[model samples]
Target: MKIIQNFTDYHEKTPLALSIGMFDGVHLGHQSIIRKLNAISEKKNLESAVLTFWPHPRTIFNPNDDLKLLNTLDEKTYLLQKNGIRHLFLKEFDEAFRNLNGEEFVRQILVKKLNVKHLIVGYDHTFGKNKSGDFSLLRKMSDECGFKVEQVEAVDFHEKHISSTQIRNALAVGNVKEANEMLGYIYSVSGKVIDGKKIGRTIGYPTANISSDPLKLLPKKGAYIVEVFVKNRKYKGMLSIGTNPTVNGNSLSTEVYILDFNEDIYGEEISVNFRDFLHEEIKFENIEKLIERLDEDKKLTDNFIF
Candidate 1:
C-alpha cells in the first residue's frame, strides 16, 4: 500500500473508495469497513484507500493524559497492508486541522482534494469539528458532492461490538485471548533487542531484552505465551513483562526466552506475538523459585495451541 503522510503531495488522478479513521488497532470493526471499501473499489474500479489520522486526536486534545496505543504507527500500517487496501493516507491531527467542521471537511478535503468517489464508514463513524459528522451527515453530503456512501454495521464478538478501545481494555488486563478475538489476529509488540542485566542468562533460561516504543501499550505485567519472530524465522517463547523483583530490580522490562534457541540477537529487530496469559509475575522467595516458575512457563509455551 502507498502511504501518503501529512505534507506529502497527494495528486492521484484516479478516484478513491475511502474509509477514514485513526484505526488504532485496525480491529475487526475497522476491517469490516475496509472490506467494504475493497468490494466497492473492485465494483467501481476505484482505488481502495483509508484516510487515518496520527498523533491520535486524544493526544492532541488531552496532552496531559497518558496515552497507550494498541499498535504503533508502523504496526498499524503493516496490519492495514494485510487487508489489501491500495492507499493509506495519514492526516496529521493538529490544531489547524481540528478547526474544520463537517461540511468544510467534506468539501475541501474529501470532495475536492481526494476526489473520493465512494465512501465507506463504520456504523458509529464520526468526524470533523466536535465530531459532529456522522452517518447522517455523510449521507447528506454524498448527495450534494456527487458521490456514494455506505456504512458497515458494527462487527460484534459474543454480542459485544469489536472495537479498538475494547481491545485495549482487554490487553490492559492481560486478556490477550479476548483481545485477539476482537482484533481478528494475535496482538503483537515489535521492538529492537537491547542489552540488559542478563539476569536470565545466569539461570538456565536466557532472554532477549526488547526496547519498544514508549507509547506502545504493553500487556499487564506478567508472563505470556508468545510466538517470537527473529531473522524472518519464528519460534515459540515465554515472555515476561515486569521488573525482576526476584533480583531486586527496579525497572520494568519485556524479556523473552525462546525455546530451543540460543544465538546473540541483541540490537536486532524482533516481534513477539502474544497468544495467552500464562501467569502473573511473582517475586519469588529466591532465584531458585523463579527458575522453577520459568520452567513451568516454558512448558506452557511449548504446548500452547492456537
Candidate 2:
C-alpha cells in the first residue's frame, strides 16, 4: 500500500473510498469497517484508503498516562495492506490538527483536499476539534459535499464488543489465549534484538533480549509460551517479562529463550507471539532453584505447543 504521511501528500488521480479512525489494533470491528471500505472502493473503482493518526490523539491529550499502543505504525500498515487497503494517510496529530473544527475538516480536508468519494467510519467514531464530529455531522457533510458515508456497527463476540481496549485489558491480565481469540491472530511483539547481561547463558538458557517499542503496549509481567520469528523462521520459545527479582529486580526486560537452539541473534529483528501465560515471575532462592523452575516451564510449554 502507498503510505501518505499527510493529506497534502495525497496526489492519487483516483478518488479514494476511505475509512477514518485511529485503527489501533485493527481488531475485528476495524476489519469490518475496512472490508466495507474495500467493497465500496471496488464498486466505485476508487482507491481504498485509510486515515489514521500517529502518536495517537490520546497520547497527546494525556501525556502523563502510560500510553500503550497495540500496533506500531509499521505493524498497522502491514495489517491494513493485508486486508486490501491500497493507500494509507498517516497524519501527525499535533497542535494544529487539534484546532481543526468539524465542518472545516470535512469541507477542506476530506472533500476539497482528499477528494474522498465515500467514507467508512466506525459507529461510535468522532472527529474534528474536541471530537465534536459524529455520524450525524458526517452524514450532513457527506450529503452537502456529494459523497457517501457508511457507518459500521461494532462487532461483538458472545455479547462483548470487540475493541482494542478490551484486547489490551486481556493482555494486561496475561490472558494471551483470550486476547488472540479476539484479535483473530496471535498477540505479537516485534522489535530488534539487543545485548543483555549474559545471565541466562550462565544458567545454560541463553536468551535473545528484544527491545520493545517504547509506545507499544506490553502484556502483564510473567513467563509465557511463545513463538519467536527470526530470519523468517519460527521457533518454539519461552518468553519472560519481568524485573528479575532474584537478581536485584532493578530493570524490567522481555527476553526469549528458544528451546534447543543456540545462535547469536544480536542486532536481528524478531517478533514473538505469545501463545499462553506460563507462570508469574518470582524470585528464586538461588541459581539452582531458578534452573529447576525454568526446566519445569520448558516441560509445561512443550505440552501446550501444537
lDDT of 1 by residue, 85-122 (tens): 88999999977779999888898899988999999988
**How well does model 2 score by local distance difference test?**
0.88
Error of 2 at 255 (Å): 0.8
Give the alpha carbon lDDT tens digit for every residue of 3-108 in model 2: 8886675665579899888888888889899889998898899999999998788878888888888898888999999999998889998888889988888988
Evaluate model 1: give its TM-score.
Answer: 0.97
Among residues 3 or more apart in sequence or in different chains, the pairs in candidate 2 whose N, CA or C atoms overlap within 3 Å are: none
Worst 10 residues of 1 by lDDT: 5-14
User: Can you give the lDDT of residue 79 in candidate 1?
Assistant: 86
Per-candidate Cα lDDT values, in order, are 0.90, 0.88
Candidate 1: residue 274 lDDT (0-100) = 95
Using lDDT, give the best candidate's number. 1
